[model samples]
Target: MTQQERRRGRDETEEERADRMWGELIQEVRVAQTGVQILFGFLLTVVFQQKYASLSQADQAIYIVTVVLGACTTGALIGPVSLHRLVSGRRVKPQAVRLASRMTFVGLLLLLVTMGSSLLLILRVATNNGYVPYLVTAVILWYLVCWYGLPLWARRKHSSDG
Candidate 1:
């Protein structure tokens, strides 16, 4: 096999590979975007709720942080579409795909934090229990294992086989 075939691990050219990667990335981003948007929308309304005024100062701070994280996550997930539109047909799909992938990963991390914080606030308010932090920590750990650990392990295990 030629060097190029070995490098790409496929018969397609760079442009074709970029196209495939871009499509897959966009699909993944679509799912994340929808979720973030919905979460952000809900967050935006929380401030106007009647019970919001009764929340403890600490809970208020947590809510603020969570909302900010959600906003940031929304921006990171949506950034690729803006990036693609601005750079379309510029022969930069490969680079764009790489950057977008990174942004998505960061967005996922932000989403994880936002969800954890949101959960903590809700549980603290609902149950008024001292164990809220521990529960949130456990849930975040589960998220980390599912979202990152398994993927990294599979990547390592499978890539070496090739």
Candidate 2:
């Protein structure tokens, strides 16, 4: 095959492709990291609020779970930077990119759950209506469709791969 044919999507060598992908991955991670940081920080202060003492046992449990999920999400989103720092100059850029990509995907999933849990807690505290779970479920479904479904559909429909 010609050199161009071997390059497939881009006219770059494997190392060059890895470099580009790593840069893009880091940029994506930065956006997610900012959001998760803000959310985790907010979650941390929730226990100090006077209203926290009045929360029902179930709501308190939910708050604890949400805070934990926020922390995990923050860790996952920040993981790529640490991965790159440790793996840099180790001749494993491609592997690092793949691993970081996986971490970012997991981070996004965790973020979705965290946001949903936070919303559930907030809405439940705001009202004692029976429709809270249904409302939260609908919003979670919307998030899943927006974050995963559309991207997967585009990948399958538009990509060269079968």
C-alpha RMSD values across all candidates: 2.6, 2.9
Shift of residue 24 alpha carbon in model 2, Å: 1.0
Per model, state how many residue pairs clash: 0, 0
Stretches of candidate 1 exceeding 4 Å from the true structure:
1-8
**What would the per-residue lDDT of candidate 1 be over residues 1-162, giving only the tens digit for each residue?**
765555567678889999999999999999989989999999999999999999999999999999999999999999999999999989999999999999999999999989998899899999999999999999999999999999999989866653
Global CA lDDT of candidate 2, please?
Answer: 0.92
Positional deviation of residue 33's Cα in model 1 after best superposition, in angstroms = 1.1
Relative to the true structure, how large is the alpha-carbon lDDT of every model?
0.92, 0.92
Using TM-score as the measure, the top candidate is 1
For model 2, how does the per-residue alpha-carbon lDDT over 1-162 read when each residue is reduced to its tens digit?
Answer: 765564466778889999999999989888888888888899899899999999999999999999999989988998888998999999999999999999999999999999999989999999978999999999999999999999999987766443
Clashes of 2: 0
Query: Which residue pairs clash in candidate 1?
Result: none
